[model samples]
Target: MPSDSALPQEDLAVRLRDGDADALAAVYERHSRLVHTLALRALGNHHDAEDVTQQVFVAAWRGRHNLDPGQGPLAAWLVGITRHAVADLLAQRARTVRNLHAVAAQPAEPATASLDGAVTDRVVVAHALASLGEPRATILKLAFAEEQTHEEIARRLDLPLGTVKSHIRRGLLQLRENIRGVRADAS
Candidate 1:
């Protein structure tokens, strides 16, 4: 039997369009390394790159019906998906950073003593967020600053619901520790 790699691109495209998991696997085998390299170069981190690579293939498979064998090679189509995924990752990272800064630097109310205390608390929370990194920082910002529900955060971030929840839980714990330390140091 001919290996999947030997099969014509048109045949593979048709197989993929028909929802053949094997064809998707073959397509992934042929192009996943390219996707990973592109993601890694764009994201500059191994975990995010790997996540984008998986997301690229999953997005391609989910949208297989739209794949046109006549337009171009499957690899090119996958590359396009990878580009979108990378763009999304970067955009999300930027938004997370912005939210963290906003939360950290938010002005306190006009009340004198309360304003000082509120500003100090925001600063502590922001410091903790900056230390959490990536999705964790992002998740916490969405949950706390934006007051988004866990499901809303997961949907917006394209993360699993459980992952979003876990990040929020851990972030809150870390934030508490950091705040405690900050208070201890002040005293």
Candidate 2:
């Protein structure tokens, strides 16, 4: 296989599907920052945004195999997930704020520390990426950082369309594994 940095999405996906841990690492390295930014912009704070970003990637890994490469690139899909998670987080915050404000005399719950913990959870996601190895990591970067479509990646790397699809599917599985590994280490 080519160096993770040099391989295209399809190739990375294939490696990921085959259970290459390196692929997952590449994905995280490439896209985690973008996801974090998207989450932050929507949630309006470093912590909530960070939490949402981690959630977005976790959700993506869970549904990676089912993703259709032709529908769009991974970054677009991740952005969609970030949007949904952010909306959910905002709604939850709004509800909490409204309920607290409604009782003007009642003492508010001590949630400041908890919210900070939420932010920490997101930063941990990068640590999780460390367990993964190559192509998946690289491919993910290509999809998110570069926002390259399968066709574009194919043209850039001179690979077949089928290859690109394989990289994404496999890459997702590798990501799932990496997340699991992160949890295990945490426990």
Candidate 3:
């Protein structure tokens, strides 16, 4: 009997279908370089080409029973499988790139959470200021929010300088107490 390599292509394919490991080895030896070269050309990287080469042979071995030796050449069928394997690798690489871009495009989650917390704090402070009521709220808004000097606030509100200063100092203390209470309740 001829060695596996010495057998004609159709006989080898038949032997491969019959579960002859030697025939598969012989086939790999005969055409693996062709598959590897094709993969390298398509993928443009050595590591990826080597991986695709391994995948092609493994897939071919698993699907060996499907080979129709009389219909065509084994080399052609293997090349067809190589094309599919290269395409799969390319698609996998594309998906990885897309996932990386998606992650990069998103704002950092902690920063977003912190911004929301800051906005909430400002809202809470505003509500607390509103709760102050009367001349105190109006005086504080002019002194702090409107960024007026004590003299400017006194002049704007038509109050004495000492009265304006007193209202501002008392309003600040009340706001600090209100914020502390709110925070304590939240915790």
Best by TM-score: 1
lDDT of 3 by residue, 1-187 (tens): 9988799899998888788999999998888999999999999987678778888988989998888998799899999999999998788668757866986898864754677798888998998899888799999998778899877887888976656756776787798789988999999
Worst 10 residues of 1 by lDDT: 108-117
Report lDDT (CA) for all predictions.
0.85, 0.68, 0.86
Itemize residue pairs with steric clashes in candidate 1.
Answer: none
- lDDT value, residue 143 of candidate 3: 78
Query: Compared with the true structure, what per-residue lDDT tens digits does model 1 show for residues 1-187?
Result: 6777778888988889889999899988888899999999988987678888989988998999999898998888989999999998788778767867987898865666677687777788889789888989989888878999877998999987657856886787787787778789989
- Model 3 misplacement above 4 A: 109-187
lDDT of model 1, residue 147 = 95
Q: Residue 167 CA error for candidate 3 (Å)?
A: 66
lDDT for model 3: 0.86
Encode model 2's per-residue lDDT on 1-187: one tens digit a residue.
Answer: 5787566766665555455568666766777899998887776777566667777767777767765655666567678878888888777668657855775667755666697666666666555444445555565557656999866776777766545646655665676677777678878
CA RMSD of all predictions: 10.4, 18.3, 26.5
- Per-model TM-score, in order, reads 0.62, 0.50, 0.58
